[model samples]
Target chain A: MNEAGTTVIEARNLDLTFQTNDGPIHALKDVNLAINKGDFVSFIGPSGCGKTTFLRCIAALETPTGGALTVNGMTPDEARRSRAYGYVFQAAGLYPWRTIAKNIKLPLEIMGYSSAEQDERVNKVLELVDLAGFGGKFPWQLSGGMQQRASIARALAFDADILLMDEPFGALDEIVRDHLNEQLLALWARTEKTIGFVTHSIPEAVYLSTKIVVMSPRPGRITDVIDSPLPKERPLDIRDTPEFIEVAHRVREGLRAGHGDDV
Target chain B: MKQIIAVLTVIAALVVVWYAACIPMNIKGVLTEQERAGAEVQPPSAKDRRDLSEIGLALNNSFAIPATWEQDRPRLPAPHQVAIELWETTVQKKITSKRSLIYHGWVTLSATMLGFAIGTGLGILLAVGIVHSRVMDLSVMPWAIVSQTIPIIALAPMIIVVLYSVGIQGIIPKAIISAYLSFFPVVVGMVKGLRSPDAMQLDLLRTYNASRSQGFWKLRLPASMPYLFTSLKIGVAASLVGAIVGELPTGAVAGLGARLLAGSYYGQTVQIWSALFAAAILAACLVGLLGLIERAVLKRMGMAQ
Candidate 1:
């Protein structure tokens, strides 16, 4: 993976412990990974496994108490300050008070993008996410799935090379999730941007990722890293193939193994 | 339409009940006076008293009740008396005249408006400061709460007297009192509002590497608006109360409170009732105006329908 191209994100023994009322909560421990340019990486794990936390660290939304994590050879904080990545949270998290167009333009407004540039980028991303005609509407006016798509549009609007998404469609129903998953694949095919995705679904991991990083809870650690053997351009029916099933099974076993440690 | 009908019906019923109540509350006072004005006839027969005016005290306990429906100094002035007084002072009299309710109302309204503006501005500033600084949060919040616990009436005299001694008198002192009453709700509301954005939203701003000032202006401030308006509504009503209370200790000769003092001293219950009603009406108007602004602003913000 390191041989494919220049590394976009590198985490060396990354560690984060949160000081809580109960005591210290070990959110991440010894997370070592390298994400190459234009790679689609999915971090699959159960809740409390630090998958979301790992994604946040890459975006500089959280600080690793120990270890070195860098984005594009810059510290995550520096990269963040330099407008390096666009992040999408678990929920759509659109400002309900703002119209969809304005919501998508929030980063642009903060980053001081010209109004013309903001409008152009907002329109482009809205069309990319298939929410082109709905930018005038507010988030609450849209359905849950549509709002999530709008959130994706918001993340895509800035033209950042890296998209850090934390379970962006986790709350959606299966039907919408499948549709979004396909749209997301098409989006990746078109943009060729490096993506860091967090998910709990095994099939989603196997279907979407060039690399799947499995994580474990309770002092959250990466248990296994599996490089996928699936074709780059995969259709929805590919999930029924033996190759896809085999990769999903491997991810499942990796997750079950992590759970086994708790027992 | 339905809501209007319901409210009007309630008002009408209240006035009816008020008119009915006037009979009992004023009847004893009415009858004793009527008895005093009657011709001396201690052992008079029913026929002797019948010659007196119909429904008079000279009925000699022969009838059910006297029809003394009107009295100049009744315990509870009839609804009509208050209405007539409200009309005579507000509509017929010139607005600038000392005898006019409009003049008194203007004096009080100016104080209320000035105080509300000051209180809201101060509360918002303090709230933002409290949200941004742990020191302000720890030291100022407790005192803000403590300030509210001291009743404004007790504080009013001291505030007025101190301001007077320093050559700041009249409206400013009253406005200060109004400001005191309105401060807490705005502080409480704004703090809640400034902190309303969740962890995820904060993270979104952090990812942008937004400045703290930018975070406050773009996110926290707008987010707190719904809360801000709610507090403003509460603060407006409180400000009016403060303004009226502020007038009491100063022995104001021109505001609604002055009218109340004069009415009470002269035993003009009608005048007092009219002044009280005017104050109530003023408070309602202030609150209603804030409600309209809240709806407009929140709706524009897409926070309300």
Candidate 2:
């Protein structure tokens, strides 16, 4: 296992170009970054900025056309084959056919967990996401926030060391997003998992992430990477603090700088 | 409550139109019969009656109007005439009797059910193959569509004649034709269903390091249930039509198709209409049964929406 502060995911001059009928599309270009163990890293940028694309590259969901990207000291493909991470997409995407408990147990069942062990893990993760008594309910029976929470529980159920979330709360409202952000921080604190989050919100990137990588569109490249100076413990009111605002301002400046020629 | 009223209103309109149509259709026959019984008819001559409008002749001879509904063999049987025949064949006659609609319906239904099972099984297998292999998708899909374009009516007789030459006869030939009509819809529907999972869902399974089979049993199969039931409804109805058509070429004496042929030969329009109604009723029941099963299964799976 990699120690805290050790590099868990490293991307060097990574580039990806999609071949469409029109021509070639540069989805990612010269993207360079390192995500350390137990770090809550947020890739913040607008749509088409390759933040989600970069996260996907680390999860081996998309193959980069050029450069090197490694996860847990091995290639992303090898890490994925070894079941290195759990991914949460923008939608909850829970199978409507399965109840919350069964949905949580899906990856465990796929990974060939023992039946008793699967039950134990499902119960534990359900509680971890504050959905203790709702395991028997179907996904549609729950609200959007609860369904997304159940999705989070599903990702956490297999106990993977890496969690890759691509705008998991993007579909949620502001109040729900804030509550989930706090819960996510608490989850990270307890699990000590390396999380790579992609989002378009500056306050979200500033609040939850220990490291914020600001990115821009048009041939997708990194604009800045800001390491936060705040303590690990955070609350909803922490957004009002000067230090939080300062980091948020820096993220905003980087975003503006990335949009320079276009704006 | 509102729906029942709407349905009843439609039925009433149909019956009224049907009775009015019978007046025009059977007017000449009624007038001829009335003239033979020493009654005066309009135009006074059979040759002159042929040249005038049937509706005009019916209005001029108002005394013969009531007899038009009671014709022994009219061009179009009145609604009540067909209804009485349906009741006699289905309810009045014993189910074991050859004249009973229930007996003929059962024979046709057996073939339809057999063919439906075979078609559904073959369709699902082909769909699975197509979804899994690009070669199967490229080759089999176009052939499946082309098979549907070839009229089953033209194909049914050849199948029956070919099978009759061999020892393979009766239900199997009819069932094969039924299966042929049915399998295409199932293949198209199941293929769509099996591939219903979005890219994100597939990517989620990929992230879990799930194998191809795991992705299928866990996601694809369950996702396909709704589509499967929908296709089954269509397939079952098609199967009934195929079975009825299959009975036509062989001059089979035991099914609804035989009943239709016999009725037509004797100019028994009432019998033909009754048999048509029976076949339609059978098809409706099969589709309704499938719908009930769909609701139950989807409700159990919590996929009703």
Candidate 3:
């Protein structure tokens, strides 16, 4: 792993304006932030707050209209071409025609990995996501939570150093979401990869992140970026602790403050 | 079981309606035959019979009911006449014999299958090109739509003539016509299907920096399967029609179309009806085969739901 303090993603006055028939809408505006190596960073905000857009930009799925955004000191597009990160969308988005293992092998196939190595990596990631035995099943055969886990495994199979997720658990029930959240934290701990997560949940944001960036809509921009002082090794019960509650409160304040500007 | 029973009920209703309609149509011929046989008949002269309604004649001559259904050169063959002809031509006659419906059916089917294969192959290739290239989509799609607007019946004769002039004879010309009729549905369906993957699915591949070919092979092609099968069912039926139509203008000596034409020339209504039934049955079999293949494939792909 790179040095702990080494910046993996840096956005400097990032601006994205989308021109539509109605008018120009700012998706991200004057956004400035830094995500260090191995940091679990969560971007929390309301709908249209550009939280998802920001993560998409990091993955190079969307291009910023103006300003500089870099991943691992390279342009997002360049970083993407280098396969520096894996992305999980809100939906699992598994191809129905393929088994979970085959879906996980998709990127490896595109990148021209050997057949044997592809299987090995697939098995490893399936195990990582607690879907080891379920690899033979198709996406439709699995429950939504299990399907989402398989998708996460697919993203991890390629072992990119950075993971970008856009509300990956947004569709799940609360119980399943909580369970996946704990599993995700465990996975992140084992992998030690930098993560950029976009979500609307406060406790989830507080529970999972080493740092939280709260954002709002209407010329979407960040209101505050808080570095958590909580210990890295956190359990599910950590949410009950005063420190976790304090950070959660700060995140809520930042979200409100961002929303306050629009109203 | 309920669905099968429902289908059988519908078929039974149609047969009853068909048998009822046969009475009025064949009554005149039945009357003529009976008059020739010197039987006592209302409106004794043929001219008088022409002025009288066939239904009225049938009501007056209730004795002629069985005769109406058994005429050798009847204007409309009864359901039993067509069925007997179908059964005899398909089963009693040797398959290799000229009189055999199976032989004619095979001739038409071979052309349909060949044409379907060519059309589906071309259609999928064109669809892939259209999905990937804006220029192809603009240029090729309009022509495909325009091609289908010209009725196959109107075009079949010209195609036969042109192909005959080129020394291309027999099944190839018919297959070409079949391909022409079938290709459009495939192009339309496949274009929609190949474009079926949503924005998020495409974006996932983009995040992986997957090449265009990768996107196509892994995403677009497999996604198009359900659409492909639907269009194939339609295409295969269209192909049969094309093959049958192609046979009509060419004065072909064999196949179901030839049998229909020959039967018409001789006023052999039974033969024509049998040939028509054979064609219908053949189309059903082709479509049913496609449905089976589609079900198995989609089930294996885990998309059966």
What residue pairs are clashing in model 2?
A: none
The CA lDDT at B257 in model 3 is: 92
Which of the CAPRI classes, incorrect, acceptable, medium or high, describes model 1?
high
Q: Cα lDDT of all candidates, in order?
A: 0.89, 0.93, 0.92
Best of the candidates, lDDT: 2
Error of 3 at A262 (Å): 4.7
CAPRI rating of model 2: high
Model 2: how large is the Cα RMSD against the reference?
1.1
Better of 1 and 3 by TM-score: 3
lDDT of 3 by residue, B15-40 (tens): 88888888899998888888999999
- State the DockQ of every prediction: 0.83, 0.91, 0.83
lDDT ranking, best first: 2, 3, 1
| Regions of candidate 3 where Cα sits further than 4 Å from its true position | A261-263
TM-score of chain B of 3: 0.98
True contacts kept of each: 0.86, 0.91, 0.83
Per-residue alpha-carbon lDDT of candidate 3 for residues A171-246, written as tens digits (9 for 90 to 100) = 9999999999999999999999999999999999999999999999998999999999999888899999999999
- lDDT, candidate 1, B1-305, per-residue tens: 99999999999999988877766666555555555678333334444544455334324433323344478898888888899999999999999899999999999999999999999999999999999999999999999999999988899999988988999997899999999999889999999999999999998888888899889988999999999999999999999889999989878998998999889899999999999999999988888989999999989989886
